[model samples]
Target: MKYISTRGKAPALNFEDVLLTGLASDGGLYVPETLPTFSAAEIGAMAAMDYPSLAQKIITPFVDGCIPDSDLAAIIADTYAEFRHSAVAPLVQLDHNQWVLELFHGPTLAFKDFALQLLGRLLDYVLERRQQKVVIMGATSGDTGSAAIEGCKRCSNIDIFILHPHQRVSEVQRRQMTTVVGDNIHNLAIEGNFDDCQAMVKASFANRAFLPEDRGLVAVNSINWARIMAQIVYYFYAAVALGAPARKTAFSVPTGNFGDIFAGYLAHNMGLPVERLVIATNRNDVLHRVLTTSSMRRQPLQHTLSPSMDITVSSNFERLLFDLYDRDGAAIADLLARFDEGEIAFSETAMARARSLFSSACVDDEQTCAQIAATWENCEYLLDPHSAIGVRAAMTAGIAADIPVVTLATAHPAKFPDAVKGAGLNEEVGLPLHLRDLFERPERCSVLPNDLAAVQSFMASNIRA
Candidate 1:
């Protein structure tokens, strides 16, 4: 299968190439040239497969030309070997129709681990073969920074730099990224919102001089197609447990970067029988408004208990827009420029289509805390702050009863033990045995200004020196 740039100007590439080159050269995202499909029988056959085997089957078609099945299989195996769970992403029945897919089972205690782990492995193999190196730079609201650092740290050929809002993430989230001590891993706590941090990461990519200096400059954010592909695995794992087309399932995703929900759409595209896709947001509901109506406007951001979802600007929304408008990157670039200037408008048709498949809801700080407490009472299930928003969205939207709705438990509740305790949910729910020491590590990170020029200068000087 070939991958084409959303902008329609860059050369088509196979999957391995897309993984190595995060963004298309035309300043656009890369999408599959053609989506692959499977019959119900083939989809059903997945039940007996292991995580690496299932991943090979799902991902091989996209990168078959670039990465032969032998190499691809090895990469898949190496990536999941580090995960703490026997079944990499496990599904649990929370109630009659509600299920939680636990995804924070890797070295990094967040859903981002499922993707970035594979990404780091893939980069190592590819760059080693090519006898080259890269510097991966990214921005994160919370989990992505820590996941990226954990994945790329100690790699001999690759250096990773991640920028996040200072004092923005939950204490555990901050400590996870800052605590890592690796020669190649660098974390910058910036004095700005996630949007500013994200913009800086994007600017480094857009700059012509930086591209030549670091030809391997890459991204580990959801903007990288590989990240989304890696994330789609759990949806399939959960659906098979719920009976799939044998039983059409739905999902409620607590969205921040918008990559997680977009992966569900990928599953649907790949012939998984899914009914509802509920997108749950905190006060940073820029996407909630867009899915409901044509006005994809961003207001001044709001912070909430769910610090991870405290994002007014969702960067992965650009990939969705590219698909919605039939790969029109010119139009997408126009819309993004408008959005930056605090100006965004969409057609009624686009809004209607988005709403047909997606339902959106926002949970405030009070509601988020309440949902955590209530879920524990109603189902004896403890939810993290991010998962609380998803439960609220699923309940309010009234998930299709005929279909079981899987609400993605994106992170371990133990990661936010403070919030869990505040909601009176500090019981002895078992965390993965390996991550028990997450809180005991000494954090080590650098603080930096929000200025774009300063960041660029730091990157250039450090790389050059």
Candidate 2:
């Protein structure tokens, strides 16, 4: 399957190239040239399959010409074998039709593990075959850093660097990334917010003159097509388990970068009977504003209890906009260029198309805490602040009572003990057994000023020769 850039200028690429060459040459995200759709029988058949089997079925098409089926299957199996849960992405029912798809059971305890784990393995296979060495530079608000570090730490041919806003992420989140011990793994605590760190990563990808000529820069963030491709599996997994094909399933995703929900959008187009897609956000809600106001504008990034969603710019939204504008790369480039100036509004047709499939809600910290408290009281289910935002949004989504709505539990509640305590819950939220000693682990990280040159210099100096 060939992938094309959202902005029209970049050359069409196959899956492997898209995986490696994230953030297109023309500053766009890559999307499949044509999505592989499953027939009703095909989707229905997935009900009997296990998580890995369903993953192979859904992901095979994306990596068709790049990785052999056997190798892909092995990689997938090995990747998921590390997850703490047998179901991988399990669903827990809260009310009659309200469910939370638990996605934090992986090594790093976040939904990102679904993709990053597979991505690290894919990179290992591809780079080993080609005898190439690359560098990974990623910025995270909270979870992606630890997940990416965990995923890519073992890659022999790659050196991974992750940046997170200093003092913005939770203690668990910070420790999760910093505590991992590897010569190839480096974490940077930037002095600014998430947007600043993300900007540095994007700018560095756009121009890599600082890196060694032989080492290409790779993206671990959702901009990579492989990340999004890997994520599409759980949507099918959750939907099929909840009775899809004959019954439509709806999803409410707590997203900052828009990557996770974008995967759901891809699933809908790939023949999943999705009832509605809800965009659940915390205070830094660029996506929420877009769907509600039709204007995509930058705002000051806010630090809330749900630190993972503290983002001003939703990078993956451009992929959806590319489709909304009929895959007109030139138009997408122009719109984003205008967006760089200050703000940009979509055409009425584009807005109408987006609104047709998406409804959004922006929840503040108070509501996030309330949802956490309410869910604990109602069903004895503990929710992280990000998942709390999702559950609250799903509750208010006003979908029919009969149709099931599953909130994607993006992270384990143990990752944010501060949020749990803030919810007025006296019970301690202990870390998983794997991370029980997280606070006791000795962390190694560099505190860097929010400067691209400083980051690039550090990366260049630290890369293994």
Candidate 3:
């Protein structure tokens, strides 16, 4: 399969090149030249497969020409072996048609593990074969940092650096990233919001003059095609389990970067019987605003109980926009260029197409807390703030009672104890056995100013020779 840049200027690349060269040369995200669609019988056959078997089947097409089938299967098998749950990504029913797809059972306890774990292994296989060394730089509000660190820490050929906003993420979230011990792993607490840290990562990707000429920079964020490709599996996993091809399944995803829900969009294009895709957001809801009002404007990033979703710029939205504009890279380039200046709006035709398949809701902290309390009282199910937003959005999404609406439970409640407590529940949400002593672990991190040059300089000096 070949990958093409959303902005239309970059050369078309195969899977290996897209995986390594994230955020294409022309400042665009790479998408498959054409999606691989499954027939109804093909999707129906997935129902009997186990998680790893199904994962190998769904993911094989994306990595076709790059990694050998035996190697890819081994890498995938090893990746999910790190996850604590037997199901890997399990489903829990809340109401008649409401279900929560538990995705935090991996090593780092977040939905990102579904992708990052596989990404780390893929990089190891690819880099080991080529005898190349690279640098991994990523930004996270809360979960991605820890997941990325956990996934990539063991790779021999890569030095990984993750940045999160200082004092903005939860204690567990912070400790999760900071506590991991590795010479190749470094966490930076930037004195700004999540967007600031994300922008620095993007800036570094755009210009890597600071890095050694032999070492290429890689992205661990959703911008990497591999990350998105790995994520598309769970969407299919959840749908087939809940009954797909036989019945349509809907998903309400709590997303900040738009990567997770975009994976669902890809699944829909890949022939999964999807009823609807709901965009769930907290206060920083750029995706919500764009869909509801058609205006894409930047706003001050807010710090809410759901810290992870506190992002103003939805980076992966450009990939969808590329399709909405008939894959016109030039038009996407012009739209984003105007977006850089101030604000931009999509064409009416594009807006109409988006509104047809997707609906969204923006929940504030109070509603988030209320939903958490209500879910606990009614179903005895505990939720992290991010998942609370997703559940609440799904409940009100007005999908028919017969259709199953699965809320992607993005993280474990133990990762955000503060939000769990803030819901007015006296119950203590304990960390999983693996992370029970997370707070007791010693943390090592460098506190850096929010300047891109300072971050770039640190990465330049810190990479192993």
Candidate 4:
């Protein structure tokens, strides 16, 4: 399948090219030339299959010409084999109608692993065939850094640099990225918020001549259609288990950059019977306000207990608007320019477009803590601060009861054990066996100021010769 740039100025490329190049040549995100669909019978068969088989079926149409079925299946199988869970992604019933789909079973203990692991393998397969090398630059709030590092660290053909806001992420999250000793993986403690780091990544891509000296660079963030495409699998997996299309299913996603829930929209587009996708946000609820009213604005970010979702600007929202506007690149450019200048006025139609199949709810630190306390007390379920935001939003959103509701639990509770304990949780839920002694590992990390040129110079001078 061909992938077109959201800005519509760049020549359309196939899936692997889009995956390797990341941001399009025209300073726009890549999207599928056209969305593919599957029938209920085909989706029904997914329930009886293993993850690799199902993943191959779900993704093949999008990458049909770029990847042969046999090679793609091998990549899928190899990627999930690294996961700690036998089920790949398991679902735990929370109530009669609510289930929490656990997505933190992979190495880094965050939802990004679900896709990053697979993308890593896909990259290996593609790069090996073409005998090419690429650099990956990513900006993370918290989970994305560790997950990306874990995925790309050992690849000899790839160099990865992750930029995170200094002192904004948790101690464990910080160490997870910083402490890794892999030669290919580098971490930068950027002094600004995630948006600044993201801007630098985009700026580097926009300036074609400013490519990394002696290396080509791509992005591993959700802007990579490959990453977002990989994510759509599990939402489908969860919905199929809960009976989608045959029976409607609703999803409550703990959201930050909007990539995670946008995958649900892709599932809905593929004709899965999604009732409504609920976006759960913490105190930094720029998205919640955007969906609830025409009051869409992004301010300087605030750090919170749910640090991963502490982003002020949602980058993947641009991709959604591209789809919603029927790929009108001019309209997207105008809309984004207005938003960047703080002149983003929302008409009734824009507001209506936002609220149609989507709903949003926001919870504060207090509510997140209360939700964690009550979940542990009443149901004995331990929740990290970000997952607490999701559970609380789903509980309070007053969503229609016509469908089974699934909440995407984004991270392992142990990732924020301190926050869990401080929130009055028991801290006794058994961490999976492998993470038992994670606290004891010696961590190595370099601290760098949050400057793009400083980062560029560091990479130039310090890359392993």
Candidate 5:
């Protein structure tokens, strides 16, 4: 399948090319030229398949010509084998129709593992075949850094560099990325918020002259089409588990970069019968503001309990906007240019289309804590700060009682113990057995000022010859 840039200026590319080129040359995200659809019988048939088998079927069409089916299947099996849970993405019923899809069972203990694990393997496969070396630079609020590092650490042909806002992430989140012992895995603690780090990565992608001629730059960020494509599988997995197609399901996703929920949007387009998708956010709520007020503007980024969602500039939103504008790259580019200057009004048609499938809720720390406490007391379930926001959104979504609502549990509670304690929970949330020695592990990282030149120089000096 061919992929096209959201901004419309970049040349169309196949899946492997899109995987390597995270952000398009024209400063746009890549999306499939034509989305693959599954029939009701096909989706229903997935009910009997295991997680890896289901992944192969769902992802095969996107990577058909790029990777052979047998190779893709084996890669998928290897990717998910790292997950601790047998179900991989499992669902738990909270109420009659309310559920939480636990997605933190992977090596890094976050929903990002579902995509990053596969992404790392895909990159390794392509790079190995071409006998080339590339650099992977990504910006993470919290989870993506660790997940990406864990996913790609074993890739000898690639060097992975993850930049996260220093002192903003939780201790566990920081250490998860830092403690991994691999010469090829480097973490950068940028002295700014997530947007600054993300901007640096995007700018680096736009200007490649700083890097060596033979080396290519790749992205492990959600801007990469492969990450989004990998994410789309879980939506189908969760929906089918709840009886999809014949019975429509709704999802309340705790999203920051907009990648996760955008995957749900793709699933809907791919005929998954997603009835409604609630865009759940914490205090940094540009997406909610855009949906509610039609005022697509930036706000100062805030450090919240849900550090993962502490982003004012949702990068993946551009992909959705591209579609809302009917894939007019010029129009998307112009609109975003105005958005960069300040607030830009969305066309009534675009707003209407987005509002049709999406409902949004902006919850704060107070509500996040309350949801955590309430869920623990009522349902005997502990939720991380990000997942708490999702539960809040799902509870207030006002969907019909008969239709099931699944909140995507984005991370394990142990990843954010401070938030757990703040919620008045007395119980200790310990790291998984594998990460029990996380604090004892020596960390290797570079603390850099949020300056692009300095960051680039550091990379140039440190990258393997």
Candidate 6:
């Protein structure tokens, strides 16, 4: 399959090129030239396959020309083998129709593991074949850093660097990233918010003169097509498990970067019979504002119990905008250019089209806590703050009673214990046995200012010599 940039200027590329060249040359995200669709019979047939087998079937079309089938299947099989749960992405029913799709069972205890683990294997395979090295730079509010680092730490060909907002992420989140000892892994605690870290990563992609000429820069964030492609699998897994195509399923996704929900959008396009895609956010709700009021404006990032969703700018929204504009890359480029200057209103036609299949809700900290408390009291489910926001959105989304509403549980409650305690529950959530001694682990990381040059200089000096 061929991938094209959201902006009109970049040359179209195949899967391998898009996998390596994240954030296209023209400052745009790459999307499939044309999406692959599945028939209802095909979607229903997947109900009998295990997670790894189903993953191989779903992702084969996208990577057909790039990786051999046997190689891709092995990579996928080994990826899920790292997850703590045998079910991989399991479903827990809260009520007759309300459900939670448990996605934090992977190594990092966050939904990101579903993608990053696969991405690491893919990178290792591709780089091994070409006998080349690359640099991985990513920004995280909480979960992505640890997951990315864990995924790529074993690779000998890549130097991975992750930046997170200093003192903003939870103790578990920070420790998860900082405690891993590897010559190839570097963590940065930037003295700014998540958006600042994200902007620096984007800027580095735009200008990489500071890096060695022979090395390429890669993205572990959802901007990479590989990450998004990996994410699309769970949506299908959850849907088919609950009977999709033959039955409609709704999803409530707690997203900051817009990548997770955008994958749901792709699943619906791929004929999964998705009833509704709810955009769940905390106080930093640019996505809700854009969907509800047609206003796309930047706001100050807020510190919330759900640190992961405390992002004012949602990056992957541009991919949806590209689709909303009927794949007109020039129009998307112009729209984004104006948006960067200031607020720009979304077109009424596009908003109308979005409203048909999508809905949104903004849950503040109080509501997040309340949801956590209520779910625990009623169903004995301990939800992390991010997952609390998702459950709240799904409960109040006003969908019909027959349709199943699955809230994507983005993180394990143990990752954010303070937030879990803040919900008025005296229960203490403990880390998994593998991370039982996380607090005692010696952490190694650098504290850097939110300046691109400082970060680049640090990366240049710290890379394996």
* Tens digits of lDDT, candidate 1, 92-141: 77778888888878887789998998888888888888888788899988
TM-score for each predicted model, relative to the true structure: 0.95, 0.99, 0.99, 0.96, 0.99, 0.99
Error of 1 at 247 (Å): 1.4
Instruction: Assess the local accuracy of residue 443 in candidate 2 as a C-alpha lDDT between 0 and 100.
Output: 96
What lDDT does candidate 5 reach at residue 403? 97
lDDT of 2 at 317: 94
Model 4 alpha-carbon drift over 4 Å, by segment: 208-214, 428-431
TM-score of 5: 0.99
lDDT of 6: 0.94
Q: Rate the local accuracy (lDDT) of all candidates.
A: 0.82, 0.93, 0.93, 0.82, 0.92, 0.94
| Collision pairs in model 6 | none
Q: Model 3, residue 395: displacement in angstroms?
A: 1.3
* 10 residues in a row with least lDDT, candidate 2: 427-436
Candidate 1 vs candidate 6, TM-score winner: 6
* Cα shift from native, residue 108, model 3 (Å): 0.9
Write down the RMSD of all candidates, one decimal each.
1.9, 0.7, 0.7, 1.7, 0.8, 0.7
Clashes of each: 1, 1, 0, 2, 0, 0
lDDT of 3: 0.93
For model 2, which pairs clash? 8-329
Q: Model 1 has how many clashing residue pairs?
A: 1
- How would you encode candidate 2's per-residue C-alpha lDDT over 1-465 as one tens digit per residue? 888999988999998888899999999999999999999999999999999999999999998768889999999999999998999999999999999999999998999999999999999999999999999999999999998999998888999999999999999999999999999999999999999999999999988999998999999999999999999999999999988899999999999999999999999999999999999999998999999989999998788999999999999999999999999999999999999999898899999999898999999999999999999999899999999999999989999999999999999998888889989999788888988888899999999998889999999999987
Model 2 stretches astray by more than 4 angstroms: none
Runs in model 1 with CA error above 4 Å?
208-214, 426-432
